[model samples]
Target: MNKQNVTVNDLVQAATKFRDDRDWRQFHNPKDLAISLSLEASELLENFQWKDSAKSMEENEENIYEELADVLIYSLMLSDVLDVDLNEIVLNKLEKNARKYPVEKARGTEKKYTEL
Candidate 1:
């Protein structure tokens, strides 16, 4: 499959197939999946630890992307197991954030909505 053409659903299907093919669903309870997701996120963060942004980006680009893909794949697996629509959930959260942080107040500001 072309990486550029892969979508969220495609990833979810691939993850599901991988799990099923290995009879791994028996071990993929929500809690375990969530833990894996968090662990991958920490790995992604570890790539940047003690390094400046430019250095991290330049020196560990491949590792960074690999960790990010791991995080996203685990997240998609969790979402599939939970029967959640990832894109819908993200869009809904974005809409809620837009209400909380209107462009006029949020633009060029780092403060929280209440602080603004």
Candidate 2:
């Protein structure tokens, strides 16, 4: 599949197929998967640790991309294993957020919804 056209289902299928080929499903329970997801997120954040934003973005783009892929792979795996439809959930949350952060209140501010 073309990378630019890949869907969430494609990623989930590929990731799970890799796990299944290696007989790793036995070790992919929710707790461990969640831990791995958090670890990947931390690794993604590490690319910017103590670095100026522009310098970090310029110098660590490759590392950032790799870590982002790791994070998305794990998240896609988790959603698959849990039988959660990622697209539906994201859209649902967007609806909820729209109500909370109406554009009139959130357009320019970085404040939380409650503070807005």
Candidate 3:
């Protein structure tokens, strides 16, 4: 997606186009969308909050999916505001993290690079 010209003013236009294409606008007003995003985050947290890794791994698939979609939708709104390409940013961030998490010294721990 073209990221440079898509400003906050253009977000509604793009969002409207998306809604019109899929007939989803009835459910995507600013307030409703924000609330839905928060609720979805809570649901996602429900999967792992206060639970061991094994228990978190046992979470229901649909719950995780719904929460992820909610998060992504909000992320798209934020990306639209900043005119950023999320895919590009995410991939770059992953590469940076790989640099920080090399196996030689940073293996099997959650410490930050400074601590390592």
Candidate 4:
């Protein structure tokens, strides 16, 4: 149950095995990975078209999970391609967001970034 070890290791192992077995990593450059990740996310969003939040959240979870896996898998591959530590990048981004969205400015509303 070591969080760091399991979280990233499992993802990396699975992605690595997938790439190796398919021999697809040769084309998974950083630019393509980033584009592909965004494309997968867009496809995920397509599943919930015109659905209410509560209804969509309750139904279609399997589809959502599948799309999310696509997005996340490519994300992991992108991280691998770039030699970036996923944990570190996530932590750093969170820190920056905390500063940018202090509770005083960001609480209790869906304000746009420019508004905040």
* Leading candidate by TM-score: 2
lDDT, each prediction: 0.92, 0.92, 0.70, 0.87
lDDT of 2 by residue, 1-116 (tens): 67898887888899999889999989998889999999999999999999988888999999999999999988988998899998999999999999999999899899999998
| Candidate 3 per-residue lDDT over residues 1-116, each given as its tens digit | 58887654455466547756997756555676677668778878888778885777676666777678667666566455455676688889999988987777788888888888
Could you give the C-alpha RMSD of every candidate to the true structure, in order shown?
Answer: 1.2, 1.1, 7.3, 2.7
Compared with the true structure, what per-residue lDDT tens digits does model 4 show for residues 5-115? 567857876887899799998898889989999999998998788998678878888889999989999988988888889899999999998888888989997886578
Best by lDDT: 1
Worst lDDT 10-window in candidate 1: 1-10
- Residues 60-116 of candidate 1 have per-residue lDDT tens digits of 999999999899888888998899999999999999999999999999999999998
- Candidate 1 off by > 4 Å: none
Ranking of candidates on TM-score, top first: 2, 1, 4, 3
Clashing pairs in 1: none
Cα TM-score per model = 0.93, 0.94, 0.55, 0.85
Residue 38's lDDT in candidate 2: 99
Measured with C-alpha atoms, the lDDT of residue 108 in candidate 2 is: 89
| Cand. 4 TM to true fold | 0.85
The residue ranges of model 2 lying beyond 4 angstroms of the native Cα positions read: none
Ranking by lDDT: 1, 2, 4, 3
Q: Find the number of clashing residue pairs for candidate 1.
A: 0
